[model samples]
Target: MRGTAAADRQSRPGRRALVAADLSMLRGPVSGVVVLPNRLVWAPAPAGRFDLDDPFDRLRVYEIVLREAVHEAELRRWLNGAVLVEVWPHLYLPRGVRQAWEAIHPQLAVVPAR
Candidate 1:
């Protein structure tokens, strides 16, 4: 019965890594300078705020949130849908994190032209 249950789960579609509940929940600022709380983004290095207008800053924010965020609210607070979609192809996320997000949002897989 345990084997059968495992097989059933595997057969189901849309199964993915345990990341955010959904990417659509991301409703953060699209353009602006924002400072993330230490609880969400903290390191041994000096404090550095992320400027959404800058690609590098945006990418860094996404990377940290995707990897270290412990709750969905954290993602929702710092990730905007428009910005996330635009930066999705460029973000260097872990395999599971990337797979989880891409599974729900296949459009993210489409890399934009440089």
Candidate 2:
């Protein structure tokens, strides 16, 4: 059952955070996994704080915006300057997770720092 579930998750473009282990993977070295008190969320770069005009500054504010928006308006704002990656999990993940993911991924495509 675990193997089947894992395979299903791997095959799907995105999977819901239904299990603790899967939630852990959501916390793993993968960009854009947002974890709230009760659920896990993931959003592509432009979809969440990753789309902020200034990601380094006002991070908390951006996070608040992400929790509020259920669609792409917020993301669209940042699309011009940000890369459109997979909108996997619908919110921003923790800072450590994002940092770790970036370390391993090393963004092959360069994004000009504002």
Report the error of model 1 at residue 32, Å. 2.1
RMSD of each: 7.7, 13.1
Clashing pairs in 1: none
Most TM-score-accurate candidate = 1
Full-model lDDT for every candidate: 0.65, 0.29
lDDT of model 2 at position 20:
18
Model 1 backbone overlap count:
0
TM per candidate comes to 0.72, 0.22
Candidate 2 lDDT over residue span 8-43, tens digit each? 222123431111111112211123433322221355
Evaluated at residue 106, the lDDT of candidate 1 is: 74
Judged by lDDT, which candidate is best? 1
Candidate 1 structure quality by residue, lDDT tens digits, 54-107: 888888888877666655676778777777877887887766677666665677
Model 1 TM-score relative to the real fold: 0.72
After superposition, the stretches of candidate 1 with alpha carbons farther than 4 Å from their true spots are 1-18, 44-46
